[model samples]
Target: MMEIVSSTVEIVIGLLVLIGALFSAFSAFGLLRLPDVYLRAHAATKSTTLGVLCVLSGAFFFFWYFDNYISARLLLGILFVFITAPIAGHLNGRAAYRTDVPLWEQSVQDELEPLLKGKKMKYEEKDMME
Candidate 1:
């Protein structure tokens, strides 16, 4: 019974790690092929977050089962990655936009343009006054 349980846990860990690897690979492909920074950020953050989580979870389970240990570092790393990845991506995209990084040539629309235009105009007026 113990052996059976261990084998099952091992199989699950293997699956989790494999899935994580696949997700990371997809993220890399998106980073390479996506047309613009925004899309690349989306792919990098979302998929890489998921992948790292899956891999860490697998490692957590492996250590717990095999070593009878709980790793706080692994748990903290998971939490940190989950919280920071999307935020970093969003900030990078925003910074790119504010710096006038061009969108993909074929991008259909910019939802932020109208929303930011007023702020931009205000800044321009202020600059002119100065």
Candidate 2:
């Protein structure tokens, strides 16, 4: 009975892990399909996030259940990814914009320009602006 239960759990965990990998793969597809850096950022952000969660959750279940060890590191990694991924994505997208990366021509609005217009906040000296 114990062996049967362990096998079942393993199968389920494997499925979840596979799903997570597929989600991550979808992001790669988005990188090709999406136009411009910003749109691609959305795909990169979302798919990678879900993928990380899926893989981590699978690991957590497998270790904590079948192996009989509570998974602290898996939980911690999930927490870190949850906190950092979106922030990194936003930073990357913003950097792309600051460099004047082109947006899709069909885009209806640009919120970043108005945000940038508020004031000339100087992060560096005049020579840096050039």
User: What are the C-alpha RMSDs, in order, of all predicted structures?
Assistant: 0.9, 3.9
lDDT against the true structure, each candidate = 0.97, 0.89
Across 1-130, the per-residue lDDT of candidate 1 in tens digits comes to 9999989999999999999999999999999999999999999999999999999999999999999999999999999999999999999999999999999999999999999999999999999999
TM-score of each: 0.96, 0.78
Clash statistics: count for each candidate: 0, 0
Compute the lDDT of residue 82 as modeled in candidate 1. 96
| Candidate 2, 44-83: lDDT as tens digits | 8989899989999999998898689988899999999999
Name model 1 segments beyond 4 Å from true. Answer: none
Error of 2 at 98 (Å): 2.0
